[model samples]
Target chain A: MKILVCVSKTPDTTSKVAFTDGNTKFDEAGVQWIINPYDEWYSLVRAIELKEKDASVVIHMVTVGGADTEPIIRKALALGGDEAIRVNSDSTDSYYIAAQIAEIAKQGGYDLIFTGKETLDYNGSSIGGMVAELTDAPYISLATKFDLEGTTATVTREIEGGEEVAEVALPAVVSCQKGMAEQRIPNMRGIMAARTKPLKVTEPVAADALTAIVNFELPPAKAGVKLVDAENVEELVRLLHEEAKAI
Target chain B: MSVLVFIDHADGHVKKSSLEALTYGAKVAAQLGTSAEGLLLGTVTEDLAALGKYGVTKIHQAANEALNNLDTQVYAAAIAEAVTASGATVIIFSHTPTGKAVAARVSAKLKAGLVTGACALPDTSNGFVVKKGVFSGKAFANVSINTAVKIISLNPNSYMTVAGEGTAAVAPLAISAGAAKVKVTAVNKVSGDVPLTEADIVVSGGRGLKGPENWGILLDLAKVLGAATACSRPVGDAHWRPHHEHVGQTGVQVAPNLYIAVGISGAIQHLAGVNRSKIIVVINKDPEAPFFKAADYGIVGDAFEVLPKLTEAIKKMKASA
Candidate 1:
């Protein structure tokens, strides 16, 4: 089985979010970057688990970013990706990125494509479905469990109040979430092997973005917490009704 | 060319979030000097005419059994056909599970620009800039869409639902929904009194609860307050609570009207998943717990002692009302 895992770089959860240039762009200074947790923890780990079960399964990692993103891609390869492909372009629009990935998937003839349900930074959950639409393949979003037998794959996805189990054929797209798999730490042997593995960089296809970022701003600061006396539990309820109106 | 809103339904009734979406779409249409219309993909038990109070002038119902269960492909196909037939310039959806599943597919089929989890109405002064919460609600981004047709998924609980004095004209929609390539074999449901994502108030516990057997107080409090029950990641990891009831960064991200944290230390991951909530109340034995910093109200007390009292107080208040 051929598996393609899409990876992206995100600021560590502890990093302070800020904007610059009249609040028009994200400020990246002094921000520690890591492989998006959804990608590293769920998508790639599940693919590696599949490869562990079947030694013949080959897993490839793909990312759309500038030269700065290669390190994150290398990190994914260290974790267990057999090869890496970097589309030489800054990740701009979701559609453009999805188009580039669709082009690669078409050329590579990958049977299974996996991505984090949504990128942590943009929170755009549109790419995997868009890629699936472009490729004319079945797509499952927020998949918590996946099992493959021959060409058919059984998947479980979170719906309104429960989980729906579904079956899809090969050459499908899946956006993975937490229940899919656990995180894997790269061993010294895997790190050494990743250094020698193939890392291919290619130019992106022609695509135009339909949306532009007008500005970026942080949410309003939270108010100081009001500590109610434990004995005055009624005071808290009264405030919830009068002040917060949240009751 | 009117604003079209997708009315999501389950158990034969329209979801509350969908009503909010309808009101938002109507507000947008009123801003643009046009009317708002709604499209129902499946059969619903409610009176379609009564939905006009949400400000929609027309309701298009497609009562196909295949449409009852959500299939992104089938929904996208049917909605795309509706968009073409209605000549809708803008489409609105509630940023719930169904919206997240189908909006992108419809956007791809129509080559439309989509903004998911939009927290505010579009600013039409310059062009069309929609403000959305990004980075797990830690920040906001104003996105400018240049496409002729635009699609937006409004965040749940972000907007208010307003009713007006109007009645809608219901009409049957003629469209064919193709068979889905992905087949749903079974559905395993959580029997919670309130759905976690749709709940207005969420009462969550953490490792401080100690074991699964100690969950009775939390459930009792949730039941008295008419809230949903959730747990932190560690509690779910320890199997003291089911994974579906977990609400954190790696778990379910919920933005309820009121989020009460009991026995939770509030790690950054946990906060990331819930910071968007309107009001946060923390109850912990440790006064130095990090969750207090983000909470609107804090009570440093033992959960074992505080929970029952709070539940009793809420029950008393409800009984009086």
Candidate 2:
């Protein structure tokens, strides 16, 4: 079985977010990057698990970013991926990125594809579904559990008030979240092997973006919190009803 | 052309978030000098005509039992057919789990410009700019969707529902229900009175609650306030709470009308999941806890002492009313 796992680089959770160029672009200076937690902990790990169960299963990691993102790809390779593909482009649009992945998937004829449910930075949660549509393959979002037997795959996804247990055939797309798999740190042997693993770079196919960013603005700073005495609980209720009107 | 709102439902009733989307779509239609219509794909026990109070003039029901469960590919195809039949210029969704899964597929099938997690109405004064959260609610982006057809999925709690006196005209719309590639075998419902995603108020605790044994106090508070229960990641990681209750960047992100955090020193990841909430109230022993910085109200006290008192006070207020 061959699986393609989509990876994205995001600012560390603790990074102080900033914008520049009159709030049109993100300020990348002084920012530390990490493999998005969802991608590392859930999507990639699940693919690695599937490979572990079957010796012939191979995992390929793909990302659409500049060369600076190679280190993150290598990190994913160290975790378990057999090879990596870097789509050399700054992926600012979700549709264009999906189109690029769709092109690659069409050419490779991968049996399965995985991506984080959504990126923390943009939180679009659109690419995986779009890729599924473009490829005419089944797509499952926010899958928490997955099992595979031969050509059939069973996935469990959380929906409103309950969980939906779904079964789809091979050659499907699944976006993963928590409860799918536990995070795995790279072992020393895995690290050494990743250094020699092939990291292929490819150009993006021609595709037009449907949306454009006009500008960026930071959310308004939170107002000073009104602190109420621990003993004066009613005062808190008064403020909730009268000032905040939250109740 | 009219505005189309997708009315998501489960357990035979329309979800509350759909009402917000309906109201939002109606208002958008009002702004565009058009009418608002709704598309109901599955079997529902609710009165579809009663939804007119939210501002939609017509409700289109597919009444296909196969559409009862959410299958993204199936839903997207049916909704696309409805869009073509109704000539809907703009489509609205509530950005729930169902919406997140299907909206993109619909957009792809229709080749429409799609925006999710939208926090406000489109700025039509410009060339159709929609405002949505970026950087996980730490920043906002004004996105211009330059497509003949546009799709907007509003954040769950961002829009308020405005209802008035009216009944909608219910009509059966014919559309082909594509075969679902995935077969659902079973459903395991989360055992809670309110689903966290749809809850108006969420009362969450953290490690500061000490242990699972002390959760009774927090649960009591949640019961009094009629809020769903949640936990910080640390509590879930420690196995003191179920993983489903964990709310953070890696967990379930929620945007409710009110979020009450007890004993949780808001980590950046935790805040990312909840910063979109309309109002936040934090209670912690340390006044310098980072959660307080993002909170509208703070109470410096121990959770053990605060939980009971706060619950009692709310109970008193309710009884008097």
lDDT per residue as tens, model 2, A1-247: 8899999999988888899999899999999999988899999999999988898998888899999999999999999989999999996788888889898889888999999999878889998899998998889999999999898999999897667899999789999999999989999999999999999999999987878889988988887788999999899988887787876
Determine which window of 10 residues in candidate 2 chain B has minimal summed lDDT.
Answer: B184-193
Give the clashing pairs for model 2. Answer: none
Estimate, for each residue in B55-145, the C-alpha lDDT of model 1 and write its tens digit.
9999988888778887777888889989988899999998887888788878777888889999989998889999998888789999988
lDDT of 1: 0.89
Q: What's candidate 1's DockQ score?
A: 0.77
Model 2 Cα shift for residue A26 (angstroms): 0.5
Model 2 interface DockQ: 0.80
The C-alpha TM-scores of every prediction are 0.98, 0.98
Model 1 TM-score, 2 decimals: 0.98
Q: Where does candidate 2 stray beyond 4 Å?
A: none
Backbone clashes in each candidate structure, one number apiece? 0, 0
